[model samples]
Target: MSKDDLKEAEALGRDLMWILGLIMHSGPEDRQRIALAYNQAQELVASIPKDNGDARPRIVACFERSDTYKAADDVACAGWLLTGMQERVNERDLPDWRKLRKIINNTVKMLTPPKPTIH
Candidate 1:
């Protein structure tokens, strides 16, 4: 991936971590919202094309992390996955790194729920 794209993906990963932290500390009702958001994000991820062979190992690691996320009932899946994406970008010089980074970053965005508005 280009330097800019990698930076953006890193930023998204940080945001996902912060959001997951908030959800973890919040009440059950808020956690429910986050869970719903995660469900929606699964659909979004399914629609994204991420067929990068170079990043396969990282993707596999992320899948394992995702299993831990689900086991712990945590919304930290995006954070874990983003970390994998960032690593892939740093470790590989694949021609399609840009597309891969974009897909991963978009998944992070989809995993993030909109902030609740206060009246």
Candidate 2:
């Protein structure tokens, strides 16, 4: 991929991260905002160039089953996209990218519901 393609992917990753944050904080009663953010993220992912190997297709698949709001999956997909972008930019060790990846990991953890106790 070209430099411009990497940049565009990075921008989309950042935007999707923000939208995922919004979705995390939104309540079931706030379906409108959640739906909007979901759609926006989907569009952003779709806008990513197809030359980035299979990352774009994989990320897009994360949003295909729309019945449930899988925040953890969505956040993980965004992180995966960013990871691909970082690799393409050849800056995996950059402090900024590290920090972003950390945040994405934490967000995914927080969004994941606890497992049943099986008492």
Error of 1 at 72 (Å): 28
User: What is model 2's C-alpha RMSD?
Assistant: 9.2
Model 2, which residues run further than 4 Å from truth? 1-6, 28-56, 63-96, 113-119
lDDT of each: 0.56, 0.47
Q: Which residue runs does candidate 1 get wrong by more than 4 Å?
A: 44-119
Lowest lDDT sum, 10 consecutive residues, model 1, at 40-49
Count steric clashes of candidate 1: 0
Task: Give lDDT tens digits, candidate 2, residues 83-111.
Answer: 33433333343335555565555544543
Which RMSD values do the candidates have, in order? 12.4, 9.2
Which one wins on TM-score? 1
User: Ten residues in a row with the worst lDDT in model 2?
Assistant: 82-91
What lDDT would candidate 1 get against the real structure? 0.56
**Which residue pairs in candidate 1 collide?**
none
lDDT agreement of model 2 with the native = 0.47
lDDT of 1 by residue, 1-119 (tens): 67875675566456546555665576656556555645544454444456664545545565577667758877655455555555555544645566556655655455456789999
